[model samples]
Target chain A: MIHQISVFLENRSGQLAEITHLLAENGIDIRAISIAETSDYGLARMIVNDAPKASAVLLEAGVILSMTPVCAVEVPDAPGGLAAFLQLLAEAEVDVEYMYSLFTHRAGRAYMVVRVSDETALTAHDIKLVGMDELGLK
Target chain B: MANYYQPEIETASYEQIRAWQNERLVKQVQHVWDNVPYYRQKMEEKGVTPADIQGVDDLHKLPFLCKDDLREAYPYGLMGKPLADCVRIQSTSGTTGRRVVAFYTQHDIDLWEDCCARAIVAAGGTKEDVVHVSYGYGLFTGGPGLNGGSHKVGCLTLPMSSGNTDRQLQFMTDLGSTILCCTPSYAAYLAETIHERGLKDQIKLKAGIFGAEAWSEDMRHDIEDSLGIKAYDIYGLTETSGPGVAFECEEQTGMHINEDHFIAEIIDPDTGEVLPEGSKGELVFTAITKEAFPLLRYRTRDICVLTRKKCSCGRTHIKMSKPMGRSDDMLIIRGVNVFPSQIETVLLQQGYTANYQIIVDRVNNSDTFEVMVEMNPDMFSDSLAKIADAEKELVGALKSMLGIAAKVKLVAPKSITRSEGKAVRVIDKRKI
Candidate 1:
């Protein structure tokens, strides 16, 4: 299990840029970023190099955020890797709320974080689950 | 014991106050009948002569005067004394309808100042304290009214007359201002500025007299907490003299009306029938002692209740509850009387900013009530479900407070345009 930072972004042009700028100013690198938006607001989720440090800095800068627990898994850097992971989840009836790819790959192994109802089924299937420290992220 | 500007009148028995009202109201009726032909015409149209009004009880026999009548009697029609005797004229902001010019003679100004002196005294002000008057000066009554009252109280009066925040701060700190006089919003702004500038220690304000606008009790405590001073609300209209008509005592419950000068009554806004004491209705005043502009049965349009309940402050003058809202500002959404203050109270209790906008419109033959609040960082949430929960909670609380459900929308912080003077709180788009 790894931590992901989700920020509430008002549907304004510079809101996301402001948050990202503050993150860069604090030397916290965003490993991956995805934005899901509605008409009036957006929820921007990020996998950062330093989740804890980034959370503290963003919070101190008055950004509204929540630290969500997600399963980080390393799969073969091939198209069927994601398909195989989805098939495993389907067999276990695991509900995936959302999933996004990590920016960095290690030795041709792509990393993806999945927010799910329960991750015990994936671990039961002996899937490769990675954490921030295991992936050598700060 | 409460400090009083005039003990004889301030603590006068009900009988004494009644006698003064009886004697003065009768003379005032005749004063208007003879001097202000507009009021005389109104009295005659109601088929009531000066001979018909003998005392305060006969007040209802006289016709009620509304703002429309005042607007119709524009420049000088409402003047009871000629320009020769009039020493000063203070006008209303006239944001709602038309600007009303109220004239005051030397004696009128003296009495009005005396009323303000009582307010200052009630707020724990003393001659030794430096009183700062920030209410707008020239045409607006707040500045001049409090200025005169501060003089009567013998406080070192700083006639700041609003604006120039830096100068206000310099004077406040350097002069050691003890009492602040301004609208509630300005007081809040000043408090915010003080904290932002980190000048809290230099601030010497012990008490604040805030008025000329509607504010909630929640806003009162906020100002008090921020400024480290007790905030008192003063209620008045430019029509019935100005900011010192009724003022809050240390009791912190209600404002004691200066019954010796003006007679107050509550009346059903629609039927024009005087409601019994303690009934919430549109406030009506008869300036029995005002020389230049004597208004008879002048409807204040502020909806408030009067209480004869014994006050610990020991002032015998009747106390008027803080007005719920001016009758004109009251919104009837689906037949429920909803005040913006009610929504404000709910918002503050839910840890939101006091600055909010209420938008009302009509659709499909029904009224739609919606409140737009800024999404401050503290109350923001990342989850859509959590954000929806926040909105739902606000809607539920507003429904309970307003007796009608209002849709709550959270926009970006500081999105609504706040005016230079007076933040626009309500927008009614109904063409009705």
Candidate 2:
């Protein structure tokens, strides 16, 4: 299980840039990041290299944030990679909530952080799971 | 016995109040007619004279005096006394337009102080109490009015005008100040500071006379809880001898108008017809006993109601509910009269901060209303859907409260500019 930090943000200009800049300034690297925004507010979810360190830095800077459990899986870097993995999850009855790409990859494979309720279902299918330690510059 | 500054006047009978108003109203009318040609012309146009305005019932016959009249009568057009007799002058904050210059003779100052003293005593102030006045001094009437009242009540008046919270607390603790007099917002700020500095136990405030602006009952409770005092609301405009024309008693229901000094009447702002008791309308005041700057039937523009109901405090003076909104500042959004206070009441009821801004503009020949509420850290959630749901709930609550739909935008914390003085809560950008 990987720790994903989600921050509450308004649909404002320079806000995403502000968080990214804060992470860069604090020497915390974001491994994977995605934003889901509505007409009024936005939610930025990030799988940083060091989730606890990033959470502390952001919280210390008065940023509204929370951490949740997610699993990062390596998929083959090909056109059929995501579809095959999603089909495997469907066959294994792994209820995938949402998935987004990571900024870094290892050995010709792309990393996808998937929000799922049953991590055992993924493990039951022999999926290769990656933790926060193996994501970025350790 | 209740602690009253003037027992005879505070507990005056309605008949006695009527008798005093009748005598003073007639004389004030004559004074204005003789000394103020600006008002004399108004009377001539209305075909009424001092003789016509024989008593309180005849108050309606006099032509109404509005803020525009005060502006037009700028410096001396409304003076009921000669220049030499006028010893002091207090100007309004003038957030509206032209500043209303209210002249005060020595007698007027004495009476105004007497009004403030009534408020202090009503708030449980005594000669033994050290009154800390935090209302701004100089042209603004809050400081002077409360300061004079504290002196009149023989309280150790600290003449501490607004601002400098650290020093205010320093003096408040060191001198053992027992009564606080400032705007309600300032009182709240002081309460916030006292708790933050961990000096609430050191504070000795028994009562706080908060006025010069509108505040909610919830806010009163908040300040009372933090400061350990009964919060009383004092209502008065600079146009009508400053912040002691009416005051809240121990009942905490409504402020008892000093009916002998100034007569309060509710009137329809549009038609200028006086409304009956309990009918919420624009508050019109007749400064029957004011000598230097007598405003006859001054339309206060403050929307409120009046009640002569027997108060538990035993004051026969008419009690006025807190002014709901100013007719001048009332926003007519999409043909519905929307007051920022209505929005504030809804916000406070919903357990949100009062730090909100109202934006009204015209869009495509129609009105657009929006309320920008600061998204405090507590209300923020990691889920956007939940935050949107909260915004939608606020919109529903505001629509039901204001009888019109208002776009509620939860902006970032401190995105909206905080106010130091009177908070600019409404921005009407309609080009009408």
Candidate 3:
């Protein structure tokens, strides 16, 4: 699943708000986002409801966007649930570049979006896969 | 080729050149000792008199003038002539602190322009060529020095200054600028921008004179290939009348010192002992003919080697290789010496472009050096593992070359910030 996408942005005030406003105006909801900034510019990675539509809207808005396929794994809402998933990835020699927690309307279940180095190994572990719409993000 | 002062100074026999330098050196020493108070006081402290310095061989008895001495004399303390007589003033951009100002009387300016003209002619420039000088004006020495020199050579000079790349290229193409003068980094940036805008063939630039910062040999090759122009290195300091202290001849082997105007010396940077020819050390110069600020043995702090071998172009003035590093800019990391140029050389050799940043920070009282290099756009699609491997390879290369451990981070294309002028290559974050 295309769970996470990274967008490059120039580090200027109102840039992030402008990007988010454009997405909301186009009816594409953002599930979560994280920003990494150096001295001059920023890079924003976000998980959105509709990856393809969000990308198109961003492109038309004159924003550069890149999409990467990340795993959306469902885990029990317990203390070590997230830690257990990370431990599995660590043991598999897979580097997790970034991860975000995802909440769902479904009871007693939690989903996490993770972009990792080894997608094949993660998929081969038989982790539950969820789509953009199934997460109620669209 | 206008009839500029082609005094055959370069190819003059060694004995004849020595005689000319000796006569001028004695007169310059007497004038400085009698007129400049700074030199008088220094000589008094050292118990040296003008009579003691008879020839160029006796130049070592005189005291050296380092940057601190220049700073102490601040705006114009070292000038031997009155301000009204000074035709111009050029200075180094004191990005670190106060600027080191150099004054030039009409005579000094003429000599400086003559040196610059020699550099232009050596690079194949002629009266028919339009020389575009993009070195920044105002406090910076690059602009006015080249502008005056181009005019002296009877070439149509463009005092375009720097920046506004669109206008720079427009004028360069439309006006048929044949010789480009600016910092090497800016030249590289211009070349990149020109290719991106699909105007490579429109530019008529045949030669480039690049300086103001130390650049590697690989950078010269890159700029030459990208801009389709031959790049030459010019060395000078604001303390010694701007960008004409030495220039490359047609041989392009090294920059030939204007031995007629300035006396060159290579000294051990730490011990202050004069080194034999071909030894790498700090380059020191004494302005034997400068009437305004006649600095005696001003230490340039630039690390380079001098070669006395006769060139194919027949310039007998000793040639100094392009500076590899500045003594002041060397950083001590984890008990090992590190120079930004070393990393730059490694990066360029590995086929990486010159866009890199060195981040030095202290971790547990141990200095850690991290080099962040930008990947080429074509390599952006490589697998993360491959990218990581490349980064590791760079780290290993740096370690082996510098004999020090360093962390290498490979970033996406255009990730590192680019400067319109001199690129900020080093960021010593340990202070923060």
Candidate 4:
């Protein structure tokens, strides 16, 4: 259950390159990005490669976005793979309100994408959860 | 059934309007001690003269007059009647600091258009109706005091001055306008452009008066349900002779004050004393029939309450009420007249950081405003399109220092809200 997106900008400067140039001119690929800001607007949040065609090219370029369902796991690209998956969501009490990471060209892998305030800890992490047609690189 | 352009002085008798405000405060304190020597040197330095004002209970022994004594009596030191007995001059939108002006006399524009024809016969108007007005003509006594009170209530007037909300609804639906006179935020911007042009059944309004600014009874029931009429509330002041000096009958509870040509009085705005009648202070006014600006115990930094109750539309003078706040920090927005030190003198003349706030709310029923400001660690490291072109050059230097339009937000660099004593610079949220 991965599908992210989120937007809503206006803390100005080329609004994250105007939403990554309308998702790289509609060939979408971002795979993991975060922003959050505040003091007058900013959200951003990505993990694209076409979350429904970057939410219809950022809603026909007027842009202010949304689309959630997150959890993407996969860790071990070495060093205790995200401290043993955050010590198995702190021994399954599970509550990671936010998390981010990327780096996948295989070789010992890496992903991390969480956003969990407990939605059944998305099936208590049987570990490998990176769906969207298995992120086989665009 | 309440149309009184002057039913024996709008239903007189509180002992016949205190015997016509004790015979016009004894002939306007012998006409400001025989023609204003700066209110006879503030009544000879409050030693009290005009034979110690012999009526309206010696109007608290005269001498108040504020706004820095009309900016130290600028042009013609409060002219009681010279300049060949004045015929006009209105002024004051000097937002705040110079530019009061005033004068009038043609019997002070026939008693300021008979107190704006008793607020268009207490907003039910006649002369087979059609008024219109739209306040803001020349030196601004709200469009020649309701265009000479819709030509002394013989209606059919128009003189549409304010802005052009689509040719003021094309002469308010091709001249069938049955009274509307402006400034309750331009009648909530002509009732939001007649419900956004669906032209509320081709308009034929049946009453509205409003006033230069400050409006709320939930924006008078949202401009009386988007202009289906009955919106009243008129009160005046271009130093006592502008909108109409108090109106609202049909008993929408308060206003009434023409107290036989102005007398009002609440006081104690920091020790000027006199508060008694239902407390809550600072409104003042004396003008007892202004013959070319006759302000006597003036000091109206407005904040109100005056009652005398008893009225289910019977109008026996003294009502006041709707001013409720402002012994100075000005504000009013949408109906123009703002003041946070005129947005901190256009943010310290455009260099910024006097840290800001403003806010003011009420959306669809008009007036929103905003402001916010703060960004100053070298404008918080600039470059967010140069902080949105410095919030569009501080919304064009606060719409040229408060003639209106605001929404300039910039926040984050100390994020607004610092105080140790009195810096809560306006929030408003219009519940009035």
Candidate 5:
């Protein structure tokens, strides 16, 4: 299952670089990342190659990290793919908390990682649940 | 000759002061090296010894003690004496994690009481007056520090820790409290409360000693005008023996450092280099007389200017201006340095109630700062646009004051949570 890991980061220049450097140093490849911030600090949500290992690495480095399950859907790069998925989730009574589009690899196909309440509803919609291995993250 | 209470030792000449400090410095260095392994190792690493510290000028030869040093030595790491000698333990509430505890021997407590008594006397408090101590008690050092000092001054002291404003006022009126001790914000609220209840005449408060938080001159004037009392500022930290390290005399110009007990220094916050007396820098203190946990060059992080110019009050002790703000309290909002006191200054200047909250959130990788201010009942109305305009005006004022754009939301009176003790004014939702 796609897991959303919140990496607590101080709001400073090159803070992202420091975090990314730590992740790279630990060989924890970030599949997708999005940043949410407040004035003093920020939360960086990451879909990593190894959620548990990345969490441990971050924690050992004295970085506060929180894990939440997110649904990763393989959608076509064509227009309205996200809207359709969101509409489907809405109709299924699964409220999306937050989401971010994962970077595309191939010429046409794209994917999005969404944090939602009901993972069961997302899995039931024939939305293939992408894991670290499935995305060749590691 | 000065008054008997104002001892020459307390306000010794600079040359004599240096000699006294150097003597204690030598003793303290040897005491720590022989007893506290932590200090011994640190000194060994830096190749520093008791002989190297010849005077106060050579203080930089010793390492500066930060708050982290205290945390690392948690529970009782910093104690220079055996645990049996410690009579009291006071701590700062660790909103982050573990509280920083400082042990005080009975002798240490007496010294602390004497310093606080000096503060009371500096504020012109007398034995005939009733002293109301409103500093929060328990692990916090503010309450007991002042309470003991009030008793030492032979005043009828009310050890009313904090909260229960109604009872605070009732006692103020019933007992005729002439001296009030509390954080400046609470003093302002108390003034407002007395006016609200029409008990202005019933209260007998004439002077206030406010500290434990950084406040501005405007705030001092606000509290003084509202409460019909002279407000004096005091300065100290739990590590340095609580709220009696320095105090404002009747002149209210600056807080006079009790140089006999604590050697005061101004150092660059980042570099720790000692600055000139008139320059603004972080204040550091070395406890010369404290027995149990005598801190040497404890960095206070408070940004203020120190002056040796003789005050009109005739006290020869070096005076420090009211702290502008703490280096640690500087909040980085959207790449801009913002201090909560700046927001407070703006709010007070705008004629709005101080019951406000600063909310920070991240939106699209950018920091968003929002200030929510509670409308005073007298100025509130049902008109939405008018209220919004008022909020916009406040936002504009804050932007000007802090040099950062902030969104201001005017909330209904009583909407902002009222704290009986220390108010929680800053909410960084971004951290979540």
Candidate 6:
């Protein structure tokens, strides 16, 4: 399970930069990021290198945010490899709530962090779930 | 039981009420002509005189006094008597523009209080009952008018003077106030606080005389159910005498105008033509009894209908339906009067444009006031923290200016609709 930090941002100018600047100043690197937005406000979700450190600085800066458990998987970097893994989940009728790509260290391979409607159903799939530590980085 | 302060006038016959108005209108016209030069000059310009206003039938012959006229008069030009003769003055919020100060002689005060006393009595008040007046004192007439009336009724008067909800509830519980006097929003607030504090059963209130702002029948029911009291409506303006020019009797159908002191008329707002009875139009009042500031045919700008419907309460005075709306762009939120121009003034003063929209809605039976302002291009690029800080600053400025807290939201530039003609600046979602 990877700790995904979701930050609530008012749909205004430089909101993303504010969050990124605060994280950068604290020396916390964001490994993966995705944004879901509405006309008035938006939510920026990120899987950072250090969850506790990212949470502390974001909270200190008065950024409204929360942390959730997400399953990270290392899929083949090739398009057919990614398609084959999704087909297995589709065959099992496992609903993927949301999935975002991450920067992986190993060549010819990619990281996909996903939040599924039911994580317990993932045990039936043949794909292995990767841990936050497995994504090696300095 | 029927309780009327002055039974003779309150239960007067139709003919007697008409005779009183006719006689008083004639006398008041003569008085205004001789004492108020401003009004006299207006009448002369209209080719009319005191002789022309012989009775209530001739009320139309007189000139109309609107808010602009009050502004034109300013501090004292329209005052009918010598400044020394006036015992006191009460003023409007003046949020719209210039403040309107109404001069009142001691005689005027006595009559105005008597009118309020009539309201108190109609709301089941007595010497045994305690009257808690939470209307703001000083320049606002809501407090002093009801306070004087409470004194006149010989009830144990509590001049609470608005705000400090804890103190209001403390005294209300300890003193056993039977009659509550204030704006309906404050009444609703007090009711909500009492229920939340679980002191509902401890309250001994029997009735409330609420006015000085518009309230709906549904709100009246809400207040009644929450406070466990019969909520009554009172109608008046600082231009007249304040919250007792007319009052709701037990019938609760409409407010009865004190015919002896005032003659009520409905006129087409645009045409200035008098509308017949039961016709909805702008409400106009001719003050027949006020001495220090007698205004003949003063336009109230309140839209309502006048009905001679026989009330079960037995008051012969003509009843006026609750004001449906206003002819101008004035709004009442949380019982505090607000004008769009007041918001515009604050915005422009804060270096924002006049292009803003005021959204007023009733949520959980309380007014929710929000002002959505359009950010300039420069402001639109500011950091989120800076934008939020700007909103907070505006909230403070508006609260200080209007004496009420308002939520401020900064929106994208030109997001709010703009009109070439008279811009629609307010959107009130309250069903009532």
What TM-score does each model's chain B reach against the true chain B? 0.78, 0.78, 0.77, 0.37, 0.77, 0.96
N/CA/C clash count, model 3: 0
Tens digit of lDDT per residue, candidate 4, span A9-88?
65657777967986887788887887766477556677877688788877676564667778788877898989988887
Q: Between prediction 4 and prediction 5, which has the larger DockQ?
A: 4
Worst 10 residues of 4 chain A by lDDT: A129-138
Give lDDT tens digits, candidate 2, residues B50-167. Answer: 8888799888898988878988878789998889988999987643245678999999999999999999999888899999999889888999999999999999999999879889
Per-residue accuracy of model 5 over A5-108 as CA lDDT, tens digit each: 77655445886797789889988878788876545445578888787888788767656556766667787788987778878888899987677888757767
Go through the candidates in order and give each one's C-alpha lDDT.
Answer: 0.85, 0.84, 0.79, 0.78, 0.77, 0.86
- Tens-place lDDT per residue, model 1, B371-414, is 88877766765467677777789888877666568888777666
Best by lDDT: 6
Ranking by lDDT: 6, 1, 2, 3, 4, 5
lDDT of 4 at A100: 85
Clashes of 5: 1
Interface RMSD of each: 2.5, 2.0, 6.0, 10.4, 15.2, 10.3
lDDT of 4: 0.78
Instruction: Give the top-scoring candidate (TM-score).
Output: 6
Query: lDDT tens digits, residues B1-432, model 4?
Result: 767887888787899889888888898889878888888887788798877667887788777888877887787888888788787788777654656888887888898898888878877787888888878788878888888888887888988888878988998898788778887877877887788778999998977888777777877887888787888888787888788888787768778888888888898899898988888898898888888788888887889889887887887888888887788877777666777877888887778778788889877767798988765534432123445676678798778666677887765434456688545777888776
The alpha-carbon root-mean-square deviation between model 4 and the true structure, to one decimal in Å, is 17.3
Using all chains and alpha carbons, the TM-scores for the candidates as numbered come to 0.61, 0.62, 0.61, 0.38, 0.61, 0.77
> Cα miss at B44, model 6 (Å)?
1.5
Among all windows of 10 consecutive residues in model 1 chain B, the one with the lowest summed lDDT is B330-339
Q: Tell me how far the alpha carbon of residue A129 in candidate 1 is from the true structure, in angstroms, after superposition.
A: 60
Better of 1 and 4 by lDDT: 1
Would you give me the overall lDDT of model 1? 0.85
Q: Give the lDDT of residue B309 in candidate 2.
A: 94
| lDDT for residue A80 in candidate 6, whole number 0-100 | 91
Sorted into a CAPRI-style docking class, model 1 comes out as incorrect
Q: Record all residue pairs in model 1 with backbone atoms less than 3 Å apart, i.e. clashing.
A: none
Residue B51 error, candidate 1, Å:
1.8
